[model samples]
Target: MKIGHYTYQPGARGGIASYVRRLGNAQADIGHDVEYLCRNGEGSDLPSVREVNGDVDLFETAQQRRLDVLHLHRRIRHLPEHRVPTVRTMHGNQGSCPSGSRFLKRSGRPCNRDYSVSGCLWGHLIDHCGSRRPGNVVNNFRRIETEHELAAKIPTATVSRFVKERMIRSGCMPDHLKVIHSPAPDLNRPPAPLQHKDPPRMLFAGRIEPKKGVEWLLRSLPKTDVPVFLDVAGTGDIAYMQKVKALVEDLGLTGRITFHGWVEEADVYRLIEQARAVVVPSLWHEPAGLVTLEAAAVGRPVIASQVGGISEYARDPFALQVSPGDVDELAECIDRLALDPERAASMGQQARAIARDRFSMDDFVSNIMDLYRSTVTTANGLMRR
Candidate 1:
């Protein structure tokens, strides 16, 4: 099958771009003709990946290439309306929530209300759900409306059941939505050895944002009897980063935590393998936690928030779940993992097994291929009719 993957950038940076690269390459490896379509970038070393020049239209490119399927990872204006069979993967709550984060600031709980001017605006100003910028607020609502329109027309795939439910609440047709869990990265190695050193070490990697619950993690540190050293990697939201840094000082956790800011993907995995455990303390309802999947792939036990689709993977012997924003519970989980070296190592082994057996790349690609074929067949039937 000829497949064209579309995203905002050609170079892999964040989760969507990384997934696009991984999917395209994996499909290519299995003998499918794959190409990447992007707005603009230096493009990558991958020869199949190409940049859509300013003059070239995105839809026209798909037509000229005669692509059998166009899988969209990012929201583009007219890509879904093309003659090509298109499948849009809803990676987050962008279509349903104006803030793109279904989190209520004051209460620190996931918001279920569909997008609206009055309610979301109140959320921004009063509840502190998202940005307070007047222009940004208006633009976000318009973006959500556009997203809803596209979702209604095309086959929309969500990363998890939580995301699918949110999309349904936001008015996407039930038949239009499909839940496909994000694929686990294949580390292709046994779980990293547990270095049971003094002051047990933990790692937190991903974009540093308020919704990420970095503050909650920091707060939990003081309560832990085990003085676990946390190494935070990845960067986002300068203002929020500053707030977290300040809180580190305020909580007297300056000596215990080190902010690595941003690091390459390889570096992240390296850090993950070195640490005794990984922490994903997201306050928001994560559609599916990629970080949790990565930690599992590395064969490290995870201490993750129990909210949203994270529970789907970060469960049983793989991870110790704690309620979102509960510092005491989080700290307790950390101490349990830290103090018991044998249990932590055992959990790491189970996590690796989970990654290999349940969320393999081959299974992920096969399921996607099935969805693509079905979409193409449906489109062909409509054309014939």
Candidate 2:
């Protein structure tokens, strides 16, 4: 089968890029020809990238490639006349909410105010959905429209049921939308044995954005009685970054919290290896908990916000969950896990077991291939008719 993966970004900067790389490799390993259609970025040397920057590149150049399945990792402009079968993997909440966080900035919480012209406008004007700028609101409406168009036009897959439900609530057709959990990392290269730390260090490894709730985590530190250190390892907006640093300094947590900025995937795992627990304090309904899954693969328990898909995973015997933006609860969790290494180790074991059993790359590839084949067969049938 000739399969091509498409996204706006060319490089491995975020979780979706990791998804593309992992799935592309698996498809190629099975002898199915694989290609990635994206605009080349400055920092990456990824292969099979057809460096075009806009809809023209995808509509004209991507169509010329004549792929059996053009799997999109995000929403893009596609005229109704375009014929190639496409499947979109909803990696985030951008398609459903203007903020992409589904978080109401006015109230400072996750919102379910459905995607509507008035609702979106009100969100921007009152809630600060994405930005307060009217221009950004106009663009967000257009993006939502594109999401609806693509959702109605082609097959759609989401990384989590939580995200799928959000899209459906925003008027995406429920008939074709499906949930296929993201793949776990290659765990076959010999497992990293579990080793607990003495003082305990919690790791937060993602963009320090509005939705990430890093500031909330920082605030929680003042209440925690434990001597544990927090190693924050990702970068984002400069102003927010400064605010975080200032907050850290104000709390006199300058000695306890270290900003490692952006680190490589190898370094992430290495840090995970030495850490006591990983924290995913996302204030938004995270489309999927890829980092949590990654930590699970490394035999580390995550203390994630009990919102979005993390709640779904937290329903089981893995990952400590706290209410989003709850500083006291989070502080307690830190104190509990940091002080008692045995329970943390036990949860880590459950995490490793869950990652291996439920989130395997083999299962991920099989489900995606099945969808691709079905989409191809449907396209062929239409042509024959």
Candidate 3:
């Protein structure tokens, strides 16, 4: 089958971009002809990218190529109506409000709750009538309306059950939505051997955002007795990053915390393997925590926030679940893992076992192929009728 994957803004180094890149590669590996139609230049890693300089006349090219399926990875409201089958994966709640919030009023910090009725209504009003800036108001309304239109028009796919539930609650058709967990590269490469170190190392790999709960993790450090060193990686809002640094200094944890700017994918696995445990302290309802799976692949146990789809994976023996943004509980969990060397090792082994069985790239690729084949066959049958 010939498939065309479309993304508007690529190379953001986020999960969505990573997912498309991996899916494109997986499609190639499975002997399917796939092309990534991206607006933000050509992807260096993916061999199947067809970068378009402008939005004009792109659908004509897809039609000319006779692409069987067009999968949109990003929001493009101006997408031309196509005769071919189209699938849109709703990665998050990008329509109701800004990609981050569900309400119009600013919290002055990130709010982590799932969509609320009042929040949604407030956002809609602010977008349509309340905002004084006419251009901004019009843009927000258009974006939201486009999302609703796309959801109504296309066969939608969601990355997690959490996201699917949200869509259903927001009045999307359940029949049109498919829940396919995003795939991650199988890091079958043997993990670096554990070193006998004095202080156990904890790793947090993600953008340094308030929603990521980086500050929560930092605040939790004061209660832990073990000599815990946190290696924080990734970048985000400059102000938030500065706040994190200030908090660390205020707590006199300057020595314990090290901020490593962005690291490449190749090095991430090694870093995960080296760490005693991985922490995913997300304040929000993370639809799916890919980092947790990545850490598990490296035989590293995770201490993650017990919210959203994270609970799906964190129930395993290797994972320690704590309430999101609970500094005391997070600290205690960290201390327990750090103090008990033998237990931590056992958890790591268990985590590796889970990763191999449930999250193997082979299984991910096969399941996705099954979905693609089924969708194509159904579309063909409809056309024949």
Instruction: Estimate TM-scores for all models.
Output: 0.93, 0.94, 0.88
Q: CA shift at 67, candidate 3, in angstroms? A: 1.7
lDDT of 3 by residue, 173-200 (tens): 6777777776545764776655448688
Model 1, position 290, has a per-residue lDDT of 90
lDDT by residue for model 1 over 185-232, one digit each (tens)?
986667668777777889999888777888889999999998989999
Q: Model 1 — TM-score against the truth?
A: 0.93
Residue 327, candidate 3: alpha-carbon lDDT? 86
- Evaluated at residue 100, the lDDT of candidate 2 is 79
In model 1, which residue pairs have backbone atoms overlapping below 3 Å? none
Off by over 4 Å in 1: 53-56, 79-82, 106-109, 114-117
Question: Native-vs-model 1 lDDT?
Answer: 0.84
Question: Cα RMSD (Å) per model?
Answer: 2.1, 1.8, 3.3
lDDT of 3: 0.73
